[model samples]
Target: MNLRKISTNLKLPNYALAIAQDYLPSTFFQYDFKTSNQVRPAHTDIPKPNFQEYRRKPLENPNALSSESVDNRRAIMSLFSFVGGIGTLYGCKAHLVQYVLFLSPARDVLATASTSVSITDIPEGKTMIVKWRGKPIFITHRTQQVINTERAVNLADLRHPETDDQRVQRPEWLVIVGICTHLGCVPIPNAGNYPGGYFCPCHGSHFDGSGRTRKGPAPTNMEIPTYKFLDDNTLFIG
Candidate 1:
């Protein structure tokens, strides 16, 4: 058909014919009219991701930690360490102080080697009891008769034999432990079956004016402490 007659019979606009002629291939007019139900392979080209740019970019801050910041952190740790050491030292010192205080009383008691008492406080021919080192001490001011009597005792007859002169530093003063040698009981002065002596009523042990055991179950003489005369009237006993 003539191009104008074909266009009029198809009822297509003149602009549409020109558009189809420019866009379509020359073989499009020679169709065989055969159809197949199969999916065509896609031949589209996709853009690849730029992995090199991602790898090149930095993951961290460009500037590293400053020396000043590191120094500040070290200084803070050192300060904490110093504080802990001081606290530990203070705790140890406090414990030491408490231990010293606990031992102070016993230390004071043991520090001195001697104790003094006035001789005048003990009258002549009387026995006085005093405390030394938490134990009883007997200070006897013996009369001349008592001294003679103690000196006259036979050493063979005594249970615990000791001379009167050996027991006393001076003729008038007799110092010895007041505790009975039998069982550690304190003896009553000048009140026993024996004259010018001490008696332990608990076990019936008797000590003479020289403190030598004379009667009953006592095993030894009363203990004599180390003593000396500081002056005419003051006696030092240890």
Candidate 2:
């Protein structure tokens, strides 16, 4: 038969050659694709329409098609905006979670809670070193005369002087932070008076009874940590 002869002549690889050879015998042989490019070659198997052309289609009919295309474009833009918003929200949530829940709280907060202390042990006019809120607090009973003595001193002789009202705590007692204002060296209380004041052995910085930075490289007044008195005899420091 002719099929057997063609199959043998083409040297076909498999079933495709068989199909291509057999399909040409169909009744639609008059049809062929009108236009084509390299990507898609025109097919030659389909037949032309049997009936003749009756009426021409209208050109304005494409308005509905273009409107539908615009609608599709709007829908795509809305979808993109929604996706962008969601991404921004997720990024904000991740940042908040890291700062509020994960990373920020990891740092140790040095507080006065563990550092505060109370004592009835120190002698009058003598200082007792107690840790309050992680810093040293020097609490002095400031004898009955200490208040009078502080008031009687000449204000002109004092470089950094404080009146009774300038003190954060009650004026009758002297409560000062026990760190040196100059170089952060702890000052000794009764080390041969520089007009009778707290003496810093490291740099010889002197602070008055009110913890005012009187002499040396100490730039500011001795910092007063938070504290309140419990009663007449006891002190609550923080």
The per-residue C-alpha lDDT of model 1 at residue 180 equals: 92
147-197, model 1: which lDDT tens digit per residue?
898889899998777888888989999999899998899999997876778
Worst 10 residues of 2 by lDDT: 51-60
- Tell how far residue 205 is off in model 1, in angstroms: 0.5
Clashes of 2: 6
Candidate 2, residues 9-37, lDDT tens digits: the string is: 54656685567667777443334423334
**Candidate 2 at residue 188, lDDT?**
86
Clashes of each: 0, 6
Which segments of candidate 1 are over 4 A away from where they belong? Answer: 1-105
Q: Extract clashing residue pairs from model 1.
A: none
The runs of at least 3 residues in candidate 2 whose Cα sits more than 4 Å from the true structure, single-residue gaps closed, are: 1-90, 93-112, 152-162, 192-196
Highest lDDT model number: 1
Q: What's the lDDT for all of these models?
A: 0.82, 0.66
lDDT for predicted candidate 2 compared with the true structure: 0.66
RMSD of each: 18.2, 12.2
